[model samples]
Target: MKNYLFPHIFQPIGWIMFVLSLITGIAIYSSIPVFGAGIAETLAIDSAIIGIALGALFIVCSKERVEDEMTKSIRLASLLNSIYAYVALLVGCTILINGVKFLVFAVFNLVLFPIIFVCNFRLEMHRYNKMCEDEEQD
Candidate 1:
């Protein structure tokens, strides 16, 4: 099947967006004084969330520099792994958290899978690339 991934160029943009959004969200959540005068907290938080989601989407859906069969397989495996992780997290939250904290987690849960997938995918790719380099050096 054809993979309609974004160009690899988007990965860096995604990283930038993700980092900026995370910083902004954390600052807002922590009630940083710098953000006090300009924007509504709820609006800022929501925008941060949307930024994070878009960033993750761009990161996960972008094409690798070398899009081969192995990369495709790794992508599939990462996706499956992310789903498993997501379920485990959900179960853990359901069991261990309650009240407002649980609600907070529930809101963040929307972006969790994509973030997990990106981490898993990048780790796997790093490992595979290292193995290839080792083999080449042999």
Candidate 2:
């Protein structure tokens, strides 16, 4: 089978980057003093956003330990689910929010799909692993 994903080593790196950047982004957004120290201006926010998106991309695109058709299907389904969830969010927000808050959400929207996809994919993968373990134990 042909492989297009990143090496498995990148998965851990991506997780690290995703977590650190998410923390940094949260701190900056929440007005945390020490965490936001040094990182200033809109540029800082932009950098964090870019870091988050790249980290999520690496995570979702990285190869699983056992890359098989099942994993591929899981990835595809997770992606589709993410898209549906993202669109629902957008529509709901459009109906319920406006003005500057909406603009902020729009900016953050850039990374939401990948983040959602990663979460869904991880959850499904965990379920699959647990099922496999159960089968092995029986």
Candidate 3:
């Protein structure tokens, strides 16, 4: 199979879904506006749009690899991290909450969670590969 970042169910269908989702996300978000107003706002981007884009890209790029032990571990780790991060935010809520600061953290988490998961996946992959290499050498 051609290597892609996500697993596309059907190429044409996937493309259609991707386009539709992206447009919908952008449309809803742009209602509030992204950057500015009228002609001044060159790019009116939103986190929702980014999320949609990421989902589409993920589907396009997903590999067919089965979940191995290490893969499972990585997923568990990422999930734990995400949960902890969310809990931390919840705990932080008790401290003090400036709306803007909270919004920033929310956005940051939105952008960050996937990145953290991807990194964790890579870390597990590396360990798995290294172990395999050692076994081969032995």
Candidate 4:
């Protein structure tokens, strides 16, 4: 089955937003000492979170140039692999950081799942493309 994706333009926009969000998030974290627990700091953090979430969603949902069954299968495999890896990491980290540190780690860990999936998907796609090229050359 074919999968529908966002317009080609969204991919680059998503990447830009993702980077900007990361920067904004870092800046907010850095400013926490100065701002304390005020509404401004809360708003900044919330905005950064929203931006990052939306950016990741756009990137993940964007269609590939060639959205074939093989590509879809690769995507599914990558997602499953990412989930498995994330769960393993979560379990291990829970054991290692069984305190206030775990709470902090968990917040960051939530974002890692999508990042890991995207990375794995890209790697798989690259490998598939290379294999296809090699086959064609043979």
Task: Give a tens-digit lDDT track for model 4, residues 97-135.
Answer: 978888878767757777787678879999999999999
What candidate 4 gets wrong by more than 4 Å, as runs, is 29-37
lDDT of 3 at 54: 64
> Candidate 3 lDDT (Cα, whole model)?
0.54
lDDT of 3 by residue, 23-129 (tens): 65546444655345654443334544464456544633454256445555565676677567666765676367766777755644554554454455556667877
In model 3, the runs with Cα more than 4 Å from the true position are: 1-44, 47-61, 64-73, 89-99
| Number of backbone collisions per candidate | 0, 0, 7, 0
Which ten-residue region of model 3 has the weakest summed lDDT?
Answer: 1-10
Q: What CA RMSD would you report for each candidate?
A: 1.7, 2.0, 8.0, 2.6
Q: What is candidate 4's CA lDDT for residue 95?
A: 81
Summarize candidate 2's per-residue lDDT along 1-138 as a digit string, tens digits: 677899998998999888888887887778776544444556667777888988998898999989999999999999999999999998999899989999988877877887898899999999999999999999
Candidate 1 clashing pairs, residues 3+ apart or interchain: none
Highest lDDT scorer: 1
TM-score on alpha carbons, each prediction: 0.91, 0.91, 0.48, 0.82
Per-residue alpha-carbon lDDT of candidate 1 for residues 1-138, written as tens digits (9 for 90 to 100): 777999999999999998899788788767786555555766778778888888988887899889899998999999999899999999998999999999888878877777788899989999999999999999
Off by over 4 Å in 1: 37-39
Clashing pairs in 4: none
Residue 81 displacement (Å), model 3: 4.0
